[model samples]
Target: MQQIDAKQAMAFVRQRRDTTDPTYLFSDLDRERRQQAFIASVSHQLKDAGTFTDIGKMQGVLDAVSKNIVVDSDLNLIQLAQQATSLTGGNISFSTLPITGFGTSPDGASINTVDVKQVQATVKELLTPVPLAPVPTTTAIPTAATTSPAAPASEAAPASGAAAPAPATPSAPASNVYADSTGALQGGAIACVK
Candidate 1:
């Protein structure tokens, strides 16, 4: 952001006077007032862009008023302060203009102030990050109680004969290997032996 120097500012004032444009009327102020306006304009742009809240809080002043006041992601804030120092004779200081909402009726604008609740909530959230809950673990094999048991043989009996109680099929004793081999391996472990 190239700042208008005293000479340049004077030229701008002259140009405005000759062109009948009032927008540039303030370009001819004395050094103190000119510097103040310059600083204010720059600060206004920075605030509008959300660069920093108050100029008072600016860390490095010199870089703030430099060749490029643009606050893009790649812009270096330190450099901006250094530039500011070069422009305003080190007398320039950062300040957040007091905000109280004053503008035209329909189209309004404000600066240097934000919702207190919003700011507090944001700070609180940052200070205490949320913790994630632990993920649950599930067993691969379903337990008898956790799963439905097979229907009784009588209930599954053929329509006519009552199924003879399914031939009294004896329950197999539980063993390490027997339990290991599921129904798909009914031929015993040897059936899986290569």
Candidate 2:
């Protein structure tokens, strides 16, 4: 829950472990997770601090970004700013592509390997819209006079003699190694990286 300057923020996101330290195994995936977590933290902080509403602060941020980053020649800053407003509401989310396993490159460098087909399928699934569950319709209960006695188990079986489909089970939530925590100040929470 500590506030950091620009340099500190950069270091926090870009920091990597020393391969010589056997105590902790280094993974590029972990570094990427840290970067994504840092972005979320910054987004929360900016929204909480009302930096977007402050023209001076916004201009200062824009100046820094413009000087440091190269954008497409056709890119419009105003349009980008408008799109960026979505971040203020904390609607942003990040997910990493699943890696198959770790492997050594031809150069003998360790790397994360991913299945191309699986990656494509995962990306497609992520982009696809999920249909909403249908709302249940209510039915009137039959009166005692109108209702008949329950049928025997053998007679109640389906005409096709097939069993009824099982109910769908909900999937478990994904585990995140990097979690976020609230800051001491009024500003938004900072990401707690592992």
Candidate 3:
């Protein structure tokens, strides 16, 4: 596991390029742009590559290399290349060098195996995918965003527009509860006298 900074990795890439090719001229400005482009491209490539790893049990190993892809199996490398093609407009191929090695079990135990050519061929087979053009789709369309309403416009006060309000009608006063000089209630429903 290694964290490679953009500048350091670009310098390494520049060193690896063939200096003898005069046609491959790159200035300092170009180098900077290339570095930024490469970082962006690889970031996009990894994002696409994440989808492939979600479908398998080897996700732990995939996660380890998800952010930093330096060593990976042939199958993973092919998947990464395919993802790169889908995410970035670049064709990529996968291949492994010829080397003899012991096989390992899923639990990381070494197993006895002696076929180097088969491994190399398998790696070569992983590189056969061609670049794929991104299909036009609406899956990533953003949700409907609501904007804030504008403030109300200022208005001049109206002149001579107010009308006089109608006078409220007086409610009929309730009948007087007090009795007359005789000291008896006038209504028969209530028996109290004033």
**Candidate number achieving the greatest lDDT relative to the actual structure:** 2
Which candidate has the top score in TM-score?
A: 2
Candidate 3 to truth, TM:
0.20
Residue range 1-194, candidate 2, lDDT tens digits: 88889798887778767567778876787788889888788777776776665666666766676586643344444544444556655567676888999999999998889999998787776655555455555597778844878577666655486885355655433322322233222122222243
Model 3 misplacement above 4 A: 1-12, 15-29, 49-194
Question: Which stretches of candidate 2 lie above 4 Å from their native place?
Answer: 18-20, 54-56, 129-194
lDDT of candidate 2 at residue 55, scale 0 to 100: 61
Clash statistics: count for each candidate: 20, 0, 0
TM-score of each: 0.19, 0.58, 0.20
After best superposition, candidate 3 residue 128: deviation in angstroms?
46
Q: Write the per-residue lDDT of candidate 3 for residues 75-101, one digit (tens) a residue.
A: 444444344334344432222344354
What are the candidates' C-alpha RMSDs?
29.4, 11.7, 37.8
The candidates, ranked best first by TM-score, are 2, 3, 1
C-alpha displacement of 156 in model 2, angstroms? 29
Predicted candidate 1: what Cα RMSD to the true structure? Answer: 29.4
